[model samples]
Target: MSNDLAAQHRPALFHRAWTVAVIACLTIVAAAAFAAMPGVLVDPLHTEYGWSRASIGAAASVNMTVYGLIAPFAAALMDRFGLRRIAMTALVTIVVGAGLTTVMTDVWQLTLYWGLLIGAGTGSLSMTFAATVANRWFVRRRGLVIGALTGSSAFGQLVFLPALAWIVDHQGWRPALVTLALTAGTMIVLIALLLRDHPADLGQRPYGATAFVERPKADQGAARRTLRVLYGSVRDRRFWLLAGTFAVCGATTNGIMWTHFVPAAQDAGMAMTAAASLVSMIGVFALVGTVLSGWLTDRFDPRPLLVGYYAGRALLLAALPALLGPDSGAVIVSWVVLFGLLDVATVPPTILLCRRVFGADGAIVFGWVNAVHQVGAGAMAVFGGFTRDMTGGYGPVWLLAAALCAVAAVAVYGLTPTAARTGDPAKA
Candidate 1:
């Protein structure tokens, strides 16, 4: 064939929007598997090693914090290297870190493997990946896409938690870790095959940006502007509001629940598999909530949405302490539905805030916000574990999580309208 004819006949990458959606879903599944993998091992580590709950929880705490700390830098790295390369690298790192966990014999090793390595890997798979999708793929339905991605993370937790619990019971924690590593490695190849940095890289425009004429290539404004965006957003009140709410979000969801839910369920006399299944149910609700949150973000004010979610979460946290025990199944299931529905629902709005506040710098700005979320989660995970150690239960932590959610609700509600300034009024 002639060269022109060959070029015309070549298959277009990202030819359909559904293809992008599928790739996004696959990334979320890979991400969710690793994220939930640690949770499954938490109880097993304690059972086998006779490790104190605090020690085990501390490892997870470190993981949550490191995961958060790495988010901003990870976003920057993705921006520099492109999402495809960074994601592929993260997938490999996660596999290695997870695979090594099977042989851990001490607390410090657990911390290093699960906390530093896996946490960093998960962070790379997090907001950086989310931003890549929102920034590059669909302009018209950015909110919906982000919602689905965030929902997938929650779905990972839901589907994998109980299943992993069964794996631990039948095959031991080693197999569970091995399964996670293999699954994550497979995802790396899929990502490399499917993902591109941006729509333009594939000779297409973002769904919404299509109406505008293309601008000529510019100099290194893209590089220089990252700093400007970072600096400007750091000074904004709305940024702090989003960050503060997210921090509280970390404190409540990951800081308290992901680190302790299985043990907490045990305290209430539920079996490990049963407890994990309950947590998985929460993931189901989160999937619905996050997707709805995304759809809502496109149609309404994100501030009100944030307010509602946080407030609802506060109520659930407060009720969590009173709801404990063997008879708590109904209560637990309700909490899962309510909490899950509101769980990742906060993310899309927060992303929206990032875009509105920082304009071209939304990706990196959101990265910083995600970092705050992680740090908040880390701080709480550490303290909550210590609290449980002192108190012999997670009751106090549950109450505290509720209070934090209340604070977050108020903080979100207090955000100035000017803070959410979408460039186009119609879009907002």
Candidate 2:
């Protein structure tokens, strides 16, 4: 196969990679929206069901844990079975979970539906999904595609948060849950109708490839292979570096900030709508930052980029305590803008690092790294609530996250650099 020969079969409207990227982005958007819903529901659940914050946080902790832990396996499954099949199944699972969440009367049901089922489902569509799509589809613009997809996750929060908050505030939490279910249901149909497993399925090479690159053969026993990777990864210092840094990334952003920020703001007497809008603002800045980080990953080394991002985040988090008062409008706005920029920007560079260090198995390796990230996140999600319950405020948690960010900044600097296989022309 020649480049020109592959070009001859290209679709008129867009590259199939772009089409797949769009579907992947949409899928992630739906999943991200569901992930953000718990934050908005925390107070409402307390109000309606008389659930304690710690109990709600515990359910979120379970969700976060399952969400992260399932990712590596999901990546392996996607490789062994098929992307479209896994994606479609994930969407259906999300629909079932979210639908059941609306009718749940007990906290354990919340844990089962939202924590186990929805968490696992959303895990399938996480950054690993973005990395898999980018790795399998495009050789030339993988970083940009990653950024776009990552940004789409942030954009999902931007689009859904305010409105969902409004619905939760005005109508009720049930309506908000129903909205997520419907969104997942719609994405399931879209994935089933439009998504293909791979470009090769349509008789085309990966975009930017001259010939079909032979992928590594999947291990005959995926479970054993995954366990082997986990065992091997534990001994590989580079994996620890990646996993440790990402654990902080998860702890600060998804675990502490996303899960607790709304309630933290509420504790300072901010309205739900106002707090949700602030989070939406963070989403807006995150979209820009993640996309820009993606572009930078293509052109520069990711190690320094991660160091800078972490350092900046530390500074922002360190300043958060003084910024969280009724009269701190200017400080709050600045925090939202700065924090959003740093929010998910860690993803692109982290993914780049995975590709550089892990080579052919980068996506799945990242899935394991992400699992650690979520574990850290889950720990903090529970801890943050418990801290608040014990201390009557989130001030200490913010400071703790800031300290973790500082550690991540120093830790990322220790990572040895490797050549990124960005857009390998042979890899289809």
Best candidate, lDDT-wise?
Answer: 2
What TM-score fits each model? Answer: 0.90, 0.94
Name the runs in model 2 displaced over 4 angstroms: 1-13, 214-219, 419-428
lDDT of 1 at 59: 85
Distance from true location, Cα of 217 in model 1, Å: 7.3
Residue 109, model 2: Cα distance from true site in angstroms: 1.5
For all candidates, the clash counts are: 2, 1
> What local lDDT score does residue 398 receive in model 2, on the 0 to 100 scale?
94
Per-candidate RMSD vs. true structure?
5.2, 3.0
Q: What is the lDDT of residue 95 in candidate 2?
A: 89
Cα lDDT tens digits for candidate 1, 391-416: 88788888888888988888787675
Clash pairs, model 1 backbone? 158-280, 286-340
- Note the residue pairs that clash in candidate 2: 139-423
In angstroms, the error of model 2 at 43 is 1.3
Q: What does the lDDT come to for candidate 1?
A: 0.77
The candidate scoring highest on TM-score is: 2
